[model samples]
Target: MAGGGGGGRSLEETPTWAVAVVCFVLVAISIVIEHIIHLIGKWLKSKNKSALYESLEKIKAELMLLGFISLLLTVGQSPISNICVSEKIGNSWHPCSKQKEEDAIKGEEIPDDSSEQHRRRLLMEAAGGSVRRMLAAGGEDKCAAKGKVPFVSADGIHQLHIFIFVLAVFHVLYCISTLALGRAKMRSWKSWENETKTAEYQFAHDPERFRFTRETSFGRRHLSFWTKNPVLLWIVCFFRQFVRSVPKVDYLTLRHGFIAAHLAPQSHQKFDFRNYIKRSLEEDFKVVVGISPPIWFLAVLFLLFNTHGWYSYLWLPFIPLIVILLVGTKLQVIITKMGLRISERGEVVKGVPVVQLGDHLFWFNRPRLILFLINFVLFQNAFQLAFFAWTWYEFGLKSCYHDHTEDIVIRITMGVLIQILCSYVTLPLYALVTQVIN
Candidate 1:
């Protein structure tokens, strides 16, 4: 695909429709490749009856479905662009014609396509036109004036902006909606966990305890026994966590939550992994809720600064502050855990002995391993944060023009990235550091 282009001449000279075409083609080609992969996997499954073939079949089915969605988006880009620019000149915008200095010097009037002419002149300058060519053009300034040079390389980018902004807005909405749904799901899981725990605890004391229990009546009315069977729920819970753990955070303890809860009982049948997953989801959901507000706040801050001039760079200190604070929360969690580990000197909490604290921490050997993990993570986060700061400085503070020269989506995307960096990367790192140092 063609590059998005940079500097004054990049976006300015490229025709608007040209960009849409390249993007559409790129998506189409990717879908075709994925479809081929899916077909091969299906063929392999038909020829082989191995476990690996079964997994490949599942993977192929998923890839084919995803390819269909990818194709839809690629095919939709042009219509979206056309819809955006339809009211204004009908999406027929083109680059300016190459301006001829000789014609201008001969008292000739510029044509309607003078913009296209001027871009050709600029392209020549970009191509390193010699002094003789420059001199023949009667100086670059006069040529530029004839071309009606734009501050933003206004060539074709102005029209493209509408479509880019539209997608950015869509992404923002998609993210927020998912977050809301996730939180709601967490609440449901927590409520279910509490009821399950109460029922199991009551039944644990007596074999026939659940026969006349309130939970039996409630469970029957809400869901059949088969629906909530320990085996089926375990499959769904483990699979959901596995899916989430792959691309999302909490890779380690998220899965271990179920294991820890399971192993606490002497036998596997004595503990339910489904209930454990419910408990884990309930807690993990809180972390997501806690991290989301500040990310959105920062995103909005970036959107505002997106339109601002270089004066906005004065607020650079704020970025590091955000990073530090994010790291600090993790530190707080680590520190509290560490303190609990050491406080087992027969100290009493409310009426419980401090020795019980270790039992409450996540997973086996966490007290020994977690502190080391936190420190290493902190160092890495500190390094990555500094690196991000340097790149941000180069991309924004040191760039071409100070005004709204770049697209809003670029800034919006950058802002969203920073939030990810802070929440997922740096914050966890520093939290570890803070836990150790404090």
Candidate 2:
């Protein structure tokens, strides 16, 4: 797909429609692929059944589903951008193009004072400023912007409140599901351990009461099970620690650790095998970088409180903050888990080489950190470049000059400098803070 292009050369420049098309096509392709996989799996079972083959079928199903959703978002980016801009424009009136053009011609004739342009700008900013202040003061839930009605109903006055309610519901569901599963596994393991101990006691203290004989064949399998299931034991230990053993700050790390361990295959020997790799990556990232709904809350707060001279620009700062925090948190979660040997291989038992907390700071363990940081920085810069350029081209430069510019140097230079400072300087500093704080 063609990239979303620079500031307003054409409506096509944004690729809004193209993005929608791509998203639709991706979803269709994914559905077709899913059906094909199911058909192939059925054919395999008819030809020759194997437990391994069945497992492969299941893994493939999961991986393709994940890829489908990921690509769906990639193509849906334009819609996301549209939503941002549309929300900003709200419902306020803009001057007719004819009137604007006449005004521009008259202003050019006078050229001494550009007061008309200044009034238009000041009016827009004033309206925007009031909206921002209201939002900041807990009036966001009841914003009175004259632009588009934010809520579906004309009478609605709680758009922000509705957004929060929906988001809180989803977050609560995810946390409950993960923790509940963890607790269930712990209970199962404890029950099994208790039964084993009871059997052992019967054999020792009441030899005549219970007949027991050890079998060599089963011993080999039990040893294998022991190696694989120690991670289960680790799960119990970690869950206990999480609920009762650790401080709140450390819980995020431990939560991620538990997730990584849980995601690791039960069959340790082939844990890193290709069939499982996709799952491992997805689950790992979800724990690491997934944004909480609260981020929007912060975004709203930024927009509301900082409405002074281009103060709405303050909200722009938080975009990088949110992105970096997500990335840094993900990195820390993955690094912490990998160091603990909580990868596809389940968990490490005694003597199995695993990086400790201190060992993780080494460059050797964190080559990915550098790569991720570089890519993240570049991507942020690119986004700012595209977004600001689009906005400026749409309304600023053309409107100022009636679509003509004898010297665009100042405008272009200022735009580039703003992009540079916002993307490179401000974003990287915020990321550093996230790394240290997280």
Candidate 3:
């Protein structure tokens, strides 16, 4: 099949499913063959020129041949449309080429024939091959030309090809970010234990003892006590469950505010801006925006399961960027408010607003704004890339959008259902896993 021949055709016409099945079978066969060859190779290693060695050598070569064949087949099935086909020249072709060179001739006016179809396929294949070859050959001109190949209006498969290209580009970016950020460094199951231990340590060892000399009737009433110190209310209510189990301390009189304070000094050193930012990012990574990891993980599972289906897989690219933007905006608003407060204090010079870290007030001035803008732009770009990929894929699969309305509804509903399930599962699991793991 070439150009529009493959587009909008039935699954049977392309037999893509059959191709996939063949690939799977070949892989399985190759695995079995490799194992057999490995055993024979090992057995032959003990004897240099024995009969066993000769037999094993033949088997090894066969296995290698099969492996190479399997790899080529798999690559052919890949969305990357790169393959070379050479055309046979004829006397009529020379006259047609001369006419085409002197004056552009309309291709569609030519009668459809076996020879024409063959030529078209060869030209399309050559285009694909040249695009890839240009990439391999280093130069700015080559790369610029290669960039334009996916969008050639002459090719009927241009839409499908470009959609895949955009997806491949986003996938590469995703892999790079994931590697750099180490987002999955720890499993979510261990969160509770680490958080509990940290809470316990802070409750026991806070250095600042804000003494209240006025021991009045307000103290006796208990209402004046916790109400006067909302910080005390948060600790006694939330932080005390784990703290009570750790060391010898009275819950009512244990005046350590740093136990539950966000800005408390972490072990080994007093808290600083760098460490604060590090811990903040760490917590963010561990947390799923609305719920727990298992649920979000399940949502991811659903997306992956539907990835091969047309239109169904269209939304896959957009989700990551959406999540990032949502989370990042939430964080920015929080930091902006905090920065405002820090700026008001005027004690610590420089940084964002209300938050004070050690000797400096967090400044919400020009420099911080510039930095936030840069971060926001990066986050927005990632989201847009994902969104564009999904929309572009959708556009390619259906010229008549009305035809796929039902499919669209079904996919959206499934996505929502999975995301809701994840939201429900993640919170409790996060608490449980954190307790157990670290």
Q: Cα lDDT of all candidates, in order?
A: 0.35, 0.35, 0.34
Q: Regarding TM-score, does 2 or 3 come out ahead?
A: 2
Off by over 4 Å in 3: 4-158, 165-169, 178-438
Candidate 2 RMSD computed on C-alpha atoms after optimal superposition onto the true structure: 19.4
Instruction: Tell me how far the alpha carbon of residue 159 in candidate 2 is from the true structure, in angstroms, after superposition.
Output: 18
TM-score (C-alpha) between model 2 and the true structure:
0.26
Model 2, range 1-438, lDDT digits (tens) per residue? 011212224445657887789899999987896688678668757865343244444445434443454455446533432232234454233222334434533444233575543433323223322232222222332324443323221111122223233333333333333323333323322332343235453343232232111121112212233234545534443333223232222322332233234445222322322223223322322332233234334434543443223333434434554444344334333333433342333332222222223324434656345434433433333333333343353336544322335224433444344334323332222222123222
Reference-based lDDT, residue 238, model 3: 38
* Candidate with the larger TM-score of 1 and 2: 1
TM-score of 3: 0.25
Q: How many clashing residue pairs are found in candidate 1?
A: 12
RMSD (Cα, Å) of candidate 3? Answer: 20.7
Candidate 1 at residue 116, lDDT? 41
What would the per-residue lDDT of candidate 3 be over residues 1-438, giving only the tens digit for each residue? Answer: 324323354567768878899899989987896697677667757644243344345434433543454455444432333322232221111212333322222233233673644444323323322222222112232223434333222242343344434543443353234323332322332342244346565453333433231221112222234533545543443332222221222111111122223334343123222222234333332221111244435444533344222443355434433443333333323222333343344433321111222212113432233223323323233333543445435332231221355545544454343333222222222221122112
TM-scores of the candidates in the order shown = 0.29, 0.26, 0.25
